[model samples]
Target: MEEAKGFVRRVLLLKFKAETAPNHVERLIKDYSNLVNLVESLKTWHMGKDANIKNLHEGFTHVVELTFEDDEGEAAYSAHPAHLEFHERAWPHVKKMVVIDYKPTSFHT
Candidate 1:
């Protein structure tokens, strides 16, 4: 593996509480995605429901991937009001969440 350079990827694995409604989940995704437009440093956002065929997902049912130009961009995004507001609003719906951030790298066989 080798560093791709000048990029940061944030991965969010979320398991919503069983009682959370589908409609609410949809709204959360919408609001979260909107951050990319609201925060200048947020370069990209992608989200999806879990579709893993293997039973390895523990209990997480959704995933969100965020890309930034670099570490500074990601830090700015984290401190941005849009992101803070969204996190405050959405945290209650999540039963469990795992957040991982890393510099993107290439994997070669």
Candidate 2:
């Protein structure tokens, strides 16, 4: 959707360590959720495991989405102390990750 102001969307795909525990993975998601709680600039947060319908998943098991109100908001998130903490704690458990960002070009309604 196009906004009169502005908006940003972040898509994150994650592949966890091969032997990572299920409970540890769950904690990672929970801690990630806390980033949205602590960052005032974050507009929305969502995440889930891959469906594995096809081989395209490429080992990535989880996906996360974040929405921000503007460029400033997104930038703030990158620099946020809480986010930095989460990044440090989460990176070790992640075998790989893909992050893509975009602004909506059109609105459906």
Candidate 3:
């Protein structure tokens, strides 16, 4: 059997105001998924849900994970027009953002 290789992961955390429209957020998520699908360098993508709990403050509402083969692949995706468009549309809705990039420690067996 052939072994599968693990790719570098890019994680994005975004915080939006409580007053932000849910429909707009949904639309932006859909648009982001579409853009990711069109990018050949993006091997995989996943979005996480809001971690809401009663009486406690959560810093972020959304989490996005993207895997790429290498830094070059990620760079290509960053420069893609579709991604640019998505950024333009989504930036206005965001209150704050955080990003982290790292490599997988172990490959799948």
Better of 1 and 2 by lDDT: 1
Q: Each candidate's root-mean-square deviation in Å?
A: 1.4, 2.1, 4.0
Task: Name model 1 segments beyond 4 Å from true.
Answer: 107-109
**lDDT for each candidate structure:** 0.93, 0.91, 0.82
Highest-scoring model, lDDT: 1
At residue 55, candidate 3 shows an lDDT of 27
Worst 10 residues of 3 by lDDT: 1-10
Local error of candidate 1 at residue 86 (angstroms): 0.6
Q: Could you tell me every candidate's TM-score relative to the true structure? A: 0.92, 0.90, 0.82
Prediction 1 global C-alpha lDDT? 0.93
Q: Which candidate ranks first by TM-score, i.e. highest?
A: 1
1 or 3: which has the higher lDDT?
1
- Model 3 earns a TM-score of 0.82
What's the CA error at residue 43 for candidate 1, in Å? Answer: 0.6
